[model samples]
Structures are given as C-alpha cells and as structure tokens.
Target: MIGGVTAVAANGPAVNVSSVNVTPTDPTVGETVTVEVTISNQEGSNSIVDVSSIMLRTTSEHYERVEDVGAIAPGGSLTIPITTSFDSAGEKNLLAHVSAASQSNGSRTSHLRAYYRPITIDVEAPEIDAGIAASTNNSGETTVTLTNYGNVELTDAEIRTAVDGTQRDQRSTFDITPNESESVTFDTTNYDSDAVTLTGAYTARGERHEVTRTVDLNRQVQGEIRLTSVEVTERGTAISVDGEAANIGGTDVDSVLVRIPDSETVSPASGAGEFFVGSVDASEFATFELSSSVSNGTDTLPIELTYLVDNERITTTQTIDLSTASPVSPESSQDRPAATAGGDGSAGSSGLPLIPLIVGLLVVVGGSGLLYRLWNRE
Candidate 1:
C-alpha cells in the first residue's frame, strides 16, 4: 500500500501512470541519467484530464518536478522526462507520480494522482592502477618510466631520484593515458653511489597514489695504461724510443704523457725528451716517441708516464733494455773514388790501369834508344 496508487475520486477521469524508461541502462557513479515517465487516460474515461505536475524521487533523496503539463483526452497518453545524477555506487530505488484534475458534474476536481512501480538503477565505482620502473646507463644517466595500466588516465605525474645522499626531482608536468607510458631522465655524474632509489606520484580519479623503486647503477672499475711494442734506436749520441700507449681498462683517460726523466745513465735529448699524448679512450691506443742521450756502457733505459684519470693524477715507470736497440747507419755516396789499392798494383787515387801505362812507357824508351844509336852510326 505504501507504493500503490490511490485515487481520491473514483468517478473522476481515469488518468494512470503507464511506464518508466531510464537512459544509459547501466550507469557509473557521478554520471547523469534521464528518466522518462509515460501517463495515459483510460479509454472509458468520461472527461478530459488536465495534468498539472509530474514528480520523481529516489531513495537517496534526489527529487525533480515538472509543472504545467497541459491536458490529455480520452484514449490518449503523454510522456515527461526528468534528469538527475548519483553520488554513490549501488542499486537505487526510484518512484514517480502524476498530479491531475478534471471537470465532473460542472465542478472542478483536483489532487487526483497515480504512482508507477519502483525503478532500480545500478552504478559502478571508478578503478585505478599504475606502475614505475628505472634504469641507469654507463654515462651515469638515470631514466625513469611510468606506466598507467588501468582504465583511468594519470595526471600531474612526478618523479624523484636519490643517490649518495643527494636527491633530484623532475621539473615538468606530464600525463599518461590508460595503457600508456612516459619517461624522464636525470644526470648522476657527480654522485658516487652504486645504486639509486626512485619515487613517483600521480593523480587518478581525483585520488593521489605513490610508488617506489630501486635500481643498481652502472659502475666502471678503475683501469690502467700500458706500454706495448716498445722499440729503441741509437742515432749517434741520441737515443729514441717508440711505442704504443694503450688503455687496457674500462674507462677513458686524459692528458697522457711519456717522457725520459733525468738519470745518470740516460738524459733527455735536447728539445725532444718528453712525448705528449692528449687523450686515449677505453680499449684504444696512441703512438709516442721519447728522445734521450744514453751514456756509454749503459744497457738499460728508464721510461716514465704521467696521465689523468677521473680528474686524478697518475704516474708509472718502466725500464727497457738498451742492448737490444739497433744503431742507425747513414747511406754511402756513389760519386767518390775508393781510397785503397786495386788489383795489378794500380793507384786507386788516379783511377787508371797500371799494366797498360807501363807497357806504353817501355815502348817509347826502346824506340828513342834505337833512333839515337842509328844517328851516331850515320
């Protein structure tokens, strides 16, 4: 009886509620919905019914009313629409009614009403899910990626990284759609920690959520510089050494130099003592030459190297054998005559055959003696 319709006057026009329709058969919380109600005057009515007001109400106290709905004749019907929204998620009960009046026996009859059956609406709650990940590169750069894995979009996303007691935050604002991702980067060159911690926050469905992740940083071991293929050559009083300086470590080195320091057995050659090698990257090499004056009977040479690694100075010393060094010889001239005696006792300075010259001198002397004896006989 509480939800049933009761007419005050039975002889009045038979106006009754017929049906109710709700837009969006399934609804979510915070979404607007429209309810359409139909009213009809029964075919056997005696007079036309004047519909004054249409009212709708829900169990949650949401109400709507429309007035001045005009009139409906016998065997006719009319429909009215009302709009409202739900705040919470659940199945709600709604009631609709119509207020009408009609003329009977030359007098006006008001307050005649009819009610519709209870309406049920179901609503759903919002859902949110997200995640975060981080990684570090060899150059000390850290990148953080954020993923939105749920049905809602994430807004005002931010990320922070902490390492070696130092913390850094992203400065830009960003958003990620459902099933999408975004990334941010930070420079960790000055930090000395082997690992980094990442923290992030974002807004989804008007609620704030936070996430944390930790990742190990890429760290390179301390490397060394080595000398390979060393060769020594002695030219007059000067000794020169040639070799390749190689970086045999995992990191690059700067300001590399190779020199022959002052010593009793070996002294730096004039103007060419030390060799300057600028930079050598990892698994790379550069050729260098060092000049020095090695004393007589000295069988060993000391070579020194100095360079910078990670802004720190490093020095190393090595010794090379001088006995194995080969001496450099000058090329001979082709235009000069030999200084020694040749075969047949020929003088090397004149460059003429001795046998032929001696034969010619003996013939001239014998001819001159014969001519003189014949002239004396005459």
Candidate 2:
C-alpha cells in the first residue's frame, strides 16, 4: 500500500524463518544438546541486511551461540547453529528471533526481524552417578570412570574441588555425550578423604557453564592384594616368589604401580641409582623395580618378590606378603643387649664388658701356688 502503482518500499528486508528445529529437546540435565535456526530469503528481495540481531528467551535452559553465515544478498539464505544445555529435566519455552537491519542511501535507516513462533522444547539434562571401586588403592594413584544414560551430552566435564571438595586443583576433566561414558584421575596425594564429589554438564556453544554431580566414589575396602597362597620355599641362591593381586572390588583396576615394603639395606643401595619407575601409563597397573636381594651381605643376593599392586600412590597400602629366600644366616637371634645400662644388674647394657675381672683373673693365675714356688726356685 505504498502509492498504488508508484509502489514505495518498507523499512528493512522482508525475511522469514524457513525452519526452526531444536535437537534433543528431551535432553538430560547437566548435558548439552543442539538447536538449529535456519532462515531464508522468503521474499526473494534485496532488502536483507546482516543477521545483526538474534534473540532467545527461556526459563530453565541456556545455550551457546555459533554464528557463521557471513553475509546474505537478495534471495540468499543463512543458517545459524546454537547449543543449549538444561540444568534439570522439565518443559521450556523459547522466544527466539532474528532481525535484519540495513541503511539505505541519503539518510535512511531500516530494520527487519524474522520471528519463529514461540517454540517449546523439552529439556532433559545429564545425570552421572560416579563412584570409586575401592575406598583406597594401595598404589597411591587411581582412576575414576563415569557412565551416562541420561538424555543430554555431558560437556565441560571436570572436578569441582580438591581435598574434601575445597578448591579445584590438579584434577581432570572430560565430556560424555548422551548415553556416552568417560573417566578421570583421582590423585590420592592432595586429597585423602573419601568425601568427594564430581561436577560436569552438557555444553553447546554460547556461554561457560557450571555443573555438579554426586557420584558413588566409594573406596573399595577390599580390592586389596591378599596373599591367599604364597609358596615361600627356595629358588636356588635366589628366591622366586609368585602370587596374584586380586580385585576384590566391583570395578576394574585400570592403572597402578605395585610396590613392596622394603628394608633399605635388604637390597644393596642400588648402584644402578634410583630405579626409574618408567612412566606408569595405565591408571591402575604398573611394574616398578623388582626386589634385587634378600639382605645386602655382599652382592645383590637375588630374592624373587612381587610388590602389592601400587596405583602410583593413590590406593590404600596394598597389604603385601613378602618371602625372601631364607637368608644365608638367619637374622642374628642374640639380643646384643640394650642401649642403656646402670649399676643395677638388670639394667640395659650399652657399654663394653667389665675389664677389672679380666685383669684380676690373670693376676690370680700368676699368683697360683705352683707358679710361685717355681719362680722362687729358679
């Protein structure tokens, strides 16, 4: 209705949202899902400006924006992809809009916006119940895996706190898509308390997100190394001890280092220098230096010993059973006397033997009657 036949123009380009589709509408809370907005040259005119403005309105769901289509001329189209993550499971309404604005010659400013009917989407966020297979790992280092059967994709997944859920420290992070699975490392050094929590969420694109989860990271009280049957006999001058490191827990022991409680001198101060434990690749299994000897009498008298699986240093002390070859000489049985002594006969003995008795005994023998008579006769 510009001027009948003289037909004038309107403000901005006449555009329309060709299609509005949101994926994973039923996304799991704490997980990420995608939503696509496809616009087009509905009018097939030369009025479309840059996609200057895109609007979205929602209550319990949020999204990340990813804009790509550089410019759209007349009769051209554009597609914008955005990611949304829900905090909880519920229904949501989105008032999403995209507007095109253009500046004509002289001094004219025009604006046009395409509106998608107020769209409704169902949000289902991710829920991961993570837990530990063991309460403690003897190796000191350990691993944690997560399973997600929720409706959303877990993204920006990471640990929220350090020791006892304090501050996020040297922990790890990962993403688990819908019905996907992932895991991370739980260092036993900084945090010893089993009171811990895992945090992560579904991520898409627009803004940084925050998530927290309560997992069943219970320390396995038993996945311990129990020497059920130790054949501690003798293997030549060296001892060959063999046993199994059982997983008395529910989950698998991913990576760890097995170690034995050692008496320093038992093995000569390894002239081989500190046995480099070469990188422990597995999260729950590793092979460190084997025992070199029983007791360093001379050279390393071989002793066949296997350590109680050590997960680096994250697990509880692996209850071990060590059997060294019956040392050539049993450890000295005689108590060499205590380190403290007083005049009382029952006091500990830390000093040398009484010398007076020795001297007196010699003099008495020299003074024997027979010896004295012989000396006088001579």
Top-lDDT structure, candidate number: 1
lDDT of 2: 0.48
Cα lDDT for residue 328, candidate 2: 38
Model 2 lDDT-worst window of ten: 1-10
Estimated TM-score for each candidate: 0.39, 0.31
Model 2, residue 218: C-alpha shift (Å): 25
lDDT per residue as tens, model 2, 1-378:
000121113544655565566766566565455666666654567554566655555444435434334446667777777666666677766755665554355222554444443567666544443322223354344465555554444466654444555754444457666566666665554465655555543343334444554444455442332323433333333333344434444434433333433455444224331232323222233233333344424333222222223342333443323344344343455756554445786543556455665688888987897787998999
Per-residue lDDT of 165-187 in model 1, one digit per residue for the tens? 56755644479876798898888
For candidate 1, what is the lDDT? Answer: 0.77
Candidate 2 Cα deviation (angstroms), residue 333: 70
For each of the candidates, the C-alpha root-mean-square deviation to the true structure, in angstroms, is 14.1, 21.4
TM-score of 2: 0.31
